[model samples]
Target: MIAEHAVPTSVELLRLDADSPRTAEVRRKVVGLRLAPGQQRFSGEAAHTLPRADTDPNRVPFAVLYRQTPVGFGIIDQRGILDEITAAPAEAVLLRAFYLDPEWQGRGIGRTACLALDPLVRSVRPEANEVVLTVNEANPAAVRAYRSGGFTATGERYLGGDAGPQLVMRRPVPYEGGAGDG
Candidate 1:
């Protein structure tokens, strides 16, 4: 059961467009969360450490939401559609990466981020059967939150950490505005 809450939370998920001031703000939040290290293959190098602006056509279309115009930001990239997933092949979207400015985290902001991306995922690929994400076991709170969000363990580990092991989880995605069974 989803166990819908009695009231909606403060975070509001909005699509980020190149013209919006949010494009830059979201980049700050990405680094604030320390999601991608200073230099990464996907995120970019020192000079381009900031999240790729929406104008960068080569980069993936990242959907970012804010608490308001620019108070906080959370971003989700559809990973299964990317190069890494192509190397293995899968019919799922990777929540890829997510982060909220520390002050904004633990306020269900992460969950709200997932919830916000749900519709966006559906919009792009109605055939999307699920979403896959990897969380460090060291991050106990994160594992618990994702479990509560209907994700189940896949008995898989990746990029072992000194803190603890990692696991891959998947959540069945419901198709949008469509009637059919997978």
Candidate 2:
């Protein structure tokens, strides 16, 4: 189910189904710019390795991370999106890849995307005591974003083949019936 959340001055976020054409463009942004600067593991190989589940029910693309709407997009996973992270450590769902369009950055949209996550994550797993994710070590900006939004690093990383290293961070669930658990 695609979902949207509003936060006054903050950017409005939309979680889209994988089939959304917006997914392709968003993935492209991550591949072209978002992953450069030693912050991501998205080499040409990983980019091409995008899941066959674009139209599948199990996977959904995260909102275009923009001011009014996503100038680009990001991808988040539920339970089985990836083999390593979910299979090894074993978590229920994950806030996965984040991609931002250059034109839409530098205005707190990234932060908005980060903040919006808490509610969406909690809504699906109201009983979930924790929410977890894997991020590349090179992405310090993202690390900072997660930290500011109440996540603590577990001091662990997942290496996907030779794609590079990803750090795992988590936050404890705060509200049983958060701002939007409907």
Candidate 3:
């Protein structure tokens, strides 16, 4: 179970829209994260990295909101990374550019946010049976966070990482019934 805190965490993933009025605010919040070398090379800019819905039918860009405030962002894709990684199963969805504000780092928000990704992806992309990501082995804190959130290291390392070698991680998404389950 997730830890209980004085401040309740309400996190939601909203699709990134290019023309929405809140787009600018969301971009500002996400870009302000200022990811470090390894993380920066992995995430890039959420705004620049997110593909247009039309451009890629299987990619979903999201703004990670905590208690109604923009604290981070990421993308859930049915293609791309997984194709390159090869270790993850065909039913996996690749999670990319996951970032939380520095101030919100140790508050359990990141853990909760990471845990939420599986359900979030399954909800939007039912074809995905798992969520996969690569965390730099050099960043032990991140490896720990992902593990705490239910992701397991695959023992398969990606050597093309920016700052150092990256360990491939995978979290199996449980099969939740779809619309006609009733």
Q: Evaluated with TM-score, which candidate comes out highest?
A: 3
Q: lDDT for model 2, on a 0 to 1 scale?
A: 0.54
Tell me the TM-score of each prediction against the true structure: 0.62, 0.62, 0.78
What lDDT tens digits, residue by residue, belong to model 1 across residues 153-174? 8787765333455677777666
Q: In model 2, which regions exceed 4 Å deviation? A: 1-8, 18-40, 43-53, 65-67, 81-91, 122-129, 178-182
TM-score of 1: 0.62
> Candidate 3: lDDT of 145?
77
Residue 73's lDDT within candidate 3 is 74
Which candidate, 2 or 3, has the higher lDDT?
A: 3
- After superposition, the stretches of candidate 3 with alpha carbons farther than 4 Å from their true spots are 1-8, 17-28, 36-42, 51-56, 84-89, 177-182
Q: Which candidate ranks first by lDDT, i.e. highest?
A: 3
How many angstroms is residue 167 displaced in model 2 relative to the true structure, after the best TM-score fit? 1.3
lDDT of 3 by residue, 99-164 (tens): 776656666777778777756787667767778888887778888878877889877888876677
CA-RMSD of model 2 = 6.8
Relative to the true structure, how large is the alpha-carbon lDDT of every model?
0.50, 0.54, 0.71
Ranking by TM-score: 3, 2, 1
Better candidate by TM-score, 2 or 3 = 3
